[model samples]
Target: MSWLRALKATARSGLTVERRRLEPLVAARAALGLALVVGATLALFGPGAAISSAFGAFQAAIATFQRSWRPRPTLALASGASLAVSTFLGYVTGAGTHPGPFLALLAVWTFLSGLAWAAGPTIGIIASSNVAMMLVTVTLPTSVAAAAGHAAMIAVGGVVQAALVVLLPVRRWGAQRDALADALAAEADYARRLRQDPVAPFDPVPLMTARSAAAVTPRQARSRPAELHGARGLAERIRPVLASLADPAVGAPAEGPQRDRVRELLAAAASVLDAAAHAIRHGEPVDLPPGAVAALRTPDTVAILDGPPRRAAVRLAALLDDVVETAEPRTETRTPTPTETRTQTPTAAGAQTRTQTASQSQSQPKSRARPTLLRLAPVVAARMRAELRPDSPVFRHAVRVTAVTTAGYVLGSALPLGHGYWAPMASVMVMRPDFSQTYSRSVARFGGTLVGVALATAVVEVADPGVYASASLAVACAFGMYLLMRTGYAVSQVCVAAYVVFLLGMGGSAWTQTVYERVVLTLLGGVLAMLAYAVYPAWETPRLRGRLADWLVTDGRYAASVVAHYANPAGHVCADVREALLDTRAARIAWQEALDRATHEPVRHRGLSRAAADDAGHALAQFGRVAMLMEAHLPERGAPPVPAAATLAEALRRSTERGGKAVRERRVPEWDELRETVANSGPLMTDPLLRKGAGLLLDALDDLSESLAPPTDRA
Candidate 1:
């Protein structure tokens, strides 16, 4: 993509409004918290205290909206305490006569905040919001004692919000319910999609998201709802089963009675899933769809499906029963099985892999909401350290932000704006790790700043509002922003920008000067952010090939592991294949996310063209689909092993390792060794299903190689 095209696409995204279910209760709670903080602080310590402390309220409220599995009160309290430290530090540094210390502080603060992306988006948002708060808060206090008092009040605001959350809770455990229900709902939709496009590509993001939401803090573990656990693994298992049942190559011939019966079962499965999803989401009794349930259990369909399709129908019915049982509330949780108790790893796409119930997850506190912050410290530190490499996108983001802020501050000082720091503040506040977000945020901030400045100036000029009135107005804007959280980026920015304008007006920034300065400096900061990103962008385009290579490597391990298990069923453990399946899924997800990000970057697709990307993605999807299909029909525990599978498995591992290296070296990936091994093993293979699946795998890999080849070489 060119710069012009990228900007145009981004403009559409920035302004696009989504229609989603409004969380009026959560929004009202946030607004009420802000109002209480502002009113009490203004009454006791005047408007200055109100201005500084409301940031705590604001930050805490935004924290509540983050996609974290931690309790809302915990998030609120953490945001407040962190922002307090930042406020206190900013005030202490700004108290000095020299600007050098504060500038240095700003550099270090923004850099760390930028690097916080390594910990995940939730942590990054909280960290960057703190830095933005510090930049603004430092300018509020006049003396050291005043700064301490203000910082104390800021902490008070966070405490107030947390208390309100505990006292007047709204939809408690809503996030967990929504995440789990949504994952099931997504699978239901996928089942429906596969009825038509049997081999359709499915994104496992929702499953991944539900797994994240399943993490409960130790405090929550004792009291958490029973339904949140147990069924997630069922959702994971159902996806591949649905794909295998629908695929003509695996289940039934095209345009036959078996195929039509498969379609009916698929449709029925979707309906049943949607019903289960609704029950789980709302904590209600399972309202099984009568017709769909009848179809699933019907004697005719079960009698009609034979071989793999028949087995799939039977397995599907069994899984659905388990899903319904888990979705409903139980009198007492069932005892964890030995396998579930001993393992924390969720099974990948395999019929033999049993699920780890949500109730079982409590045993693994490391994956939970960081059971104790102290316990999670080392994990977070390790993640941050891992990103400290030159080519790491997270590290590059930190460097970009540090340089952008420093440049903005220098330019702000040379300019005559009264609020020189707002330039750097705006720059750092809008910057993100990727091209789309960084550009979209810059556009939103500038547009929002314009509307905010104009509106603030007009209102002050017309009404000449007093201190209390200005604070009240600022609180109102905060509420609007919180309410409009899901609407669009530009819309929220409009409220945030207006909120800041009103707060500054209350602090006695001259209306005319504040208006013009804010308008000009906001545009300047946005431009600076854009230019900095362009100069040192973390482009995702070149990384596409490497991501693909990773997927190929993991896929090879998975298929080889499965084949090897068949070769020596006595020697290999099911855990090996299960672990390999999980690796393959993770690699697949990384490649998909990287491809999505690369699509938005304004650069050439280095080592991969657009057509090749599409074909490569499809080929890889098919490769995994073949493995999933094979997994659906694994031999019994003590069945006679296929001797030829050993040679084919070894060849698969070696060929794919070579192919991955070829990808990294910018050459076409070939699976000739595996192809030859499969051809020779064809006559030796007794199982027709396994033989045909191997052939499908060969065709998929050969297509992948051709797609990855240079255009001239292909000709």
Candidate 2:
């Protein structure tokens, strides 16, 4: 009964459809790409050639949908090359005289391909496509020469799709625009929170998600997309400032006209950000609201809103300036700096300055050199080496994929079903790194296959699609699949199942028998995938402690950097601090994902209790809020109370190290020294804002300490 209930729930979730505003555009692109490939292939090579071309077109269309842009030519070529290799290999195995060697070859290929998941989603898709192609090849009856011809035709299809992508680019700035829009919307929400309850904890998810989405690739970083990159950078810089202004402890002036001005400034800033987001999304000139500019230039606005809000308002004005600059067309060049300028001076300092200037000019070209693969090879190698550890998630996932996929292949071969390849193919598609994702995908695959096969069967019986109609159906299904791929697994699966049915029908398979075989084999494959995990699951709970410790270490370093900046505001922002913040975000994201995975695992395998995990999560979030506040203070230029700031910095750093140790060693951290440091800080600390910020940090540390305490020790 429990199993039945679970199954019912899974099916219901799988069937739920999510509609996105961009679905129509996505559907249109998919349909057009598929239609072009199918129509061209049929005209040139007839129905038989259309089969191989269709597969190629399918691969290319999916690639476009994955990134929504034409990949760099080199990457596109590499992808096409991979597809060709896989198609050829599949063809060879299918044409071989003996079944034993083919089966052995397939097992090895599946195992090796499974490792591609470690690289990322794109590579993983390529690997899976290879396996799927092999399954298709085995079903076709053809000679070696015919197989080679088909492979060539398939490669051409991929090339055609790539060409289409290059010629018809869609939504070039879509991802970046969406990211900025989300950030703006989040700022509005944050402002509302400040108005309603300044003390309420801010959710960092939206800011982080948008920033991650807006992150540029190395290639893009080198290119001259200044406006997009500049806007993204400004958005990141503005986030911490916004967070600081929303701090409840820093209240508005009680009885001053400046208080109302400050409120007006906040509203104005929010409006400007919203307008900028709209402009970026719509590709129009940014038109600031009428009162927004006036609010920034108001006589007493800066003086009255002194402290974080004042600093934030000033920065917000600078950001608006940047947005206006970005909206304008660039048509002028700046004068180049002179390499050498002779100045009459009798002192040694003059000659030294000249020498330094000459050396800097000589080195400028070297510094501006573009990155090459040779230079990046060492970094990539080192990262791969680090992830090669047996304890690493990527390594473990790779091993799991190999073992399960091999088992799936063996099971499929042993089955008496006519189309046994479907079983292993289904398994290959469903297996993922985490338990929840794998289970959900498995359920979705099963339910979706049922729906797809049923729909395809009814269509075949009622319409009896001939060659042209089958091709048309294939194009339609391909479009639908790509459109819904990100929406939900089950919804996407429905399209996939329908597409396969049309494809097989074109190959002259009996419709009823084909649907039956696919349904049974799909169910068998899903069961195999689920059972593989059940037998030796990689539960996330056991790994939570390590993940938490990593976050503590990274975040602690970031806090230390922030403290250093506070002590010496004249110094430029430290690159290490920026990198540390990024690392902290990564670590936090990983921990959250692990916690989510643990939630879905059985009680026996969930190492931490739910209450304990929730408490830790809350503590971590508070820590993030404090870190953002400290970061917000980074741009302040006035001299700080050096001794006091340094003392607080040291205490905060030491607290982080202790917290990391406690999590790692399963012991309570000693917070006595930190508490003492915070409590004994002198009245010489003149900056009220700094004092308040330090108090916030101390409170966060205390909360974290309490959360980490053993259950027996907690009140």
Candidate 3:
């Protein structure tokens, strides 16, 4: 990509407006904290303290809005505390006259803030906000005593926000409920789609979001509603089952009695799942469609579909029963068992299916137990330390940020501008670890600063508002920003820039700097951030092959794990399958993220061409789907073992691991051993579905090898 095209793409992204549902109540609540802090500080201390304290509340509110799994109040409190610390330390260093010590401290602090990206997106966002806030607030305090007083006021701001959040909550656990509900609703939609087109693609995004929401802190764990527990995993299980039942190659003939029965079951499952989703989302009584329920329970379904299709229907019905039984709203009490809640006759396999489903979905709280907020510190620390290596993008980003911020500070100070810190603040706010975000935010911030400064300056010239009026304008700007945070980054920046201008006006300073001065400094800072990335860049293109390799390794392990279960169901830990699935999902997400980031980078594919990448990705996706299908039809306890699968599973594990290494080494990946195992077990394979799925998986792998082959060899 050329610079012009990159700029165009990023600008378009930054300026694009999204139509998100505005949360007026939540916005008002956040704005009220800012209003309270500003009002109290103005009445008690003065405009300076009011301005200093408003930042704390504004930043705390922003932290609460970040994409984090931690409690919102906790996020607010932590953000407030970090801002206070940064402000106090900045005050301590700036008290000296030389400006050398402060610059050194600024560089070091900014570097650590950048390194915080290693922890995760949430921490990185909060840390950058803290850095930007510090740049503005540090210039507020004049002395050591003033620093203490201002810091205390900021802490008070945080306390006020958290208190308001706890006291007057807006739909408590709302995000979690929506996430889980969305996942179930998506599965219901997928079931309905399978009726029309059996090979319809199912998106994992909703299930991924649900899994993220289901990860609760220990404090949350104790108070979370019973219905939200393990339901995400159950939703995960439903997709493959629906697909297996629909696909003609696995479940039934293309057109016959079995196919018709399969369509009826699909429609019924959709109705039931939809009812369950609504009940869970709204805490309302379930209204299951009687016709759909009857279709699922009809004995003819069992008679028409035998083997895999029969098992899928029985399992689907059992899973649906558990979904409603778990998600059904009740008074604050422990949920009743299936037997306790309702009475029904067990089919030939429904009893075993229900028992197995309950043990897998209801018994387990989540896929894995996540640590509490207290335990998260060490985990985050470990992640940061792991990224300390030179090759890590987080490390490179830290270096770039440190250099850019310091350079901005020095250059801004060198010019005759009074508020030199504005340059570095703008840079810190806009920079990210990728080409797209860094450029997009830089463009957004600079453009917003221009419009904001001009608008605020115009207001000051025309109305000549007093201290109270200026503060009111600042608060209004903040309210607008909070309400529209989801619209776009550029939209939020306009409010932020205007808010800053009004805040400065509120301080009652005789304005020496004009609108152009502010715009120029901010533009310079943005330029510095973008230029620094050009000089010291971390390109995602080089990592594409490695990411693909990682995906292959994890996908291979998952297939082997599922295949191994068929060989010996009793010895298989269900948790292993769950773990392998999660690992593969994570790996796939990583690869896709890398690919997305690489699109904006101005570089060649390096080792993996675009065509090769697409082919390899498709192959791996098909490989994963095959495993999912196998997982859906796993054998019951005490069933006859498919001994042939053990040999195939071992071969798969060995060969795929080697294949991943070969890909990383820029060699064509081979599945010769896996093919040999399949050939050797020609007559021994008891499960024809397994044999057929294996053939499809191998065909995909062969396509991958051909795509990755040398150009000459391919011809």
Candidate 4:
């Protein structure tokens, strides 16, 4: 019953659709790609070639529809090339006389391809396509000449799929822009909550998700639109200021024009942020309310504001100025000199000017010039080196996949089961780098295959579909597979299984026997994948401590950098601050990922209880808010540094180092001594607002320390 409930929950969550607009587009592209390949093959080489080409086309279409946030044409070409090469190799090996050498070759290919997962989703999908192609190719019997021809046909199929991608490039920047808008909207909501209640607990999920979406390689950042960069930077700058403004001790003058003016300013700032978000999302002009800009510059506004509120106003002004700059285009104009006007007739002068303009345009660099592989060499090298390490999960998973697939292949061949390659293919699909995904996928694949086999068998028995009807069924299933691939593994697998069954039926296989063989072989492969994981798993709990420690260290560095900026406010340190922030964001992302993986694992594999883990996560989130507040209030030029700023900085670094060690050692550190030091440090600076902000920081740090301590008693 528990298992049934879990399955039901999984289906419900997986089937829930967001972004409905994109689904039909994806499904259409996939179906069209398949249709083109089948149609071309049937016209050029007849029905037999069409049947073979349909298999290649289905694989290519799957690769095409694998959604990536950053879509690159080069990635599509590379995927096609990989599928071609892998299919050729599989055909050659299967045609050989000896089974031992063929198995050895398969193992080596599986291991090498599995390592590609570390490079990211695009490369991972290409690798998976290679494996899928190989599984199908090895089942066919062909001579070397026939194999080469088939490989060329398969390459053509991939090219057609890639062409479809290039022809329709909708929503290229939609995901990135939407993410930035959501971040700004979240910040605006946070500000509103602060205005309503100064002590509301902040939820960091939206900001974190946005940051994750905004993260890109240096190469990507350089190529992205200037407006997007400005929006993200401005949103990050606004967050910390909002946190500072929420401090209750930052008081406004009571019952006066000043109080009313400050309240109005805060409201205006929030509205401006919301407007900026809307402008960015919709690509429309950002126009501030009539008096909003004038209000910021008014005498009353400056007179009433001080400390945190003043700082907030300054940041808000800067953000609005940036919005205006990005929204307006700049054009340079020049006047003709007296000598130039006198030297020629009007027509001659106009022609000369046109020639100069054309020459200048010709000299300018082209933005669309192809990105050289030389530029990517270093990144590829670094990823390869990282995955080569013995302790890397990618390396371990590669080895595990190689071993499992090899054993499955050997077992299938020894048994008298028809279509033995299905067993290894199942194993290939189910295995993943993480334990939880591998387990979940194994279950989903098996269950979905069973359901799919039953449906396919029933349809074939009732209709007795000929080649044309079977081909139509295959194409429809291909479309459905790509549509639900991202939405749910189980549902996608159902489509995949049905498509394969129809594809085989088109090649004149007995429907009932083919279905029986597929069900048995898939079940065997799934069980093998699960067993492999159980024997050698990459459990997340053991790595969680290290991930948490890494986050602490990076957060400490970011906090330290912010404090140092106050001591030497004149120094130009924006680059250093930005780098530190990026590092902190990266570390936070890693910690969150590790925690999520741990949550999915069984209790026996988890080092900490779920409740304890949740408590620690909450503590870390609170600490992040305090860090943002400290960063928000860096001293301006000629402004005096808080007297206790240096002391607080030192304490923060020491406490973070201590906390990291405690996590690494899996034991509690003594926080009483640090608590006493912070309590006795006294009034934290001259400005009442800075003092209050420091007090909040100390309280957050204390909470973090307490959370790191072990529970007093466990059941």
Candidate 3's C-alpha lDDT? Answer: 0.84
Ranking by TM-score: 3, 1, 2, 4
Question: TM-scores for all candidates?
Answer: 0.92, 0.86, 0.96, 0.82
Give the number of the best model, judged by lDDT.
3
Candidate 1's C-alpha runs over 4 A off are 331-371, 568-573
> What does the lDDT read for residue 598 in candidate 3?
86
Q: How displaced is residue 580 in candidate 1, in Å?
A: 3.0
Candidate 3 versus truth, CA RMSD in Å, comes to: 2.4
Q: Report lDDT per candidate.
A: 0.80, 0.65, 0.84, 0.66
Tens digits of per-residue lDDT, candidate 4, 1-715, equal 1334534543444344434334678678868878888777767875555655676667766665554544444455566566667767777775346677778788888987778788775566567557856777655536777777667777777777778877876555666677777887887787677666654565555665555556555466676665465455556666666666555545444445645655666666667667767766776666555455555545454456664565555455544455444433232422221122222222332344334323422342222222344565577657856898778888888888898888888787777877877888888887888876776777788878888878888898899998778888888888888787776678788888898888888777778767878888888988898788768777777888788777776776677666656655632225576677778777887888888866665534245556666666666666666666666666544667655656666666787778788877877544554455456655555655445555665666556556666566322
How well is each residue in 112-188 modelled by candidate 2, as lDDT tens digits? 55555555566566667667666765445377776677777667766766676567657655665676677766775
Clashing pairs in 2: none
- Residue-level lDDT of model 3, residues 439-555, one tens digit each, is 989988888888777788888888888999989999999999999999988888888888988888889764346466678889999999999999989999999988988998898
On TM-score, the candidate that comes out on top is 3
Q: What lDDT is reached at residue 395 by model 4? A: 85
RMSD of each: 5.0, 7.0, 2.4, 9.0
Between candidates 2 and 3, name the one with more favorable TM-score.
Answer: 3
Question: What pairs collide in candidate 4?
Answer: none
At residue 380, give the lDDT of candidate 3: 84
| Model 1, span 493-579: residue lDDT tens | 888877888887777765776777877887888889899889998999998889999999899889888777676664222667767
Runs of candidate 3 exceeding 4 Å displacement: 332-346, 366-369, 510-514, 571-573
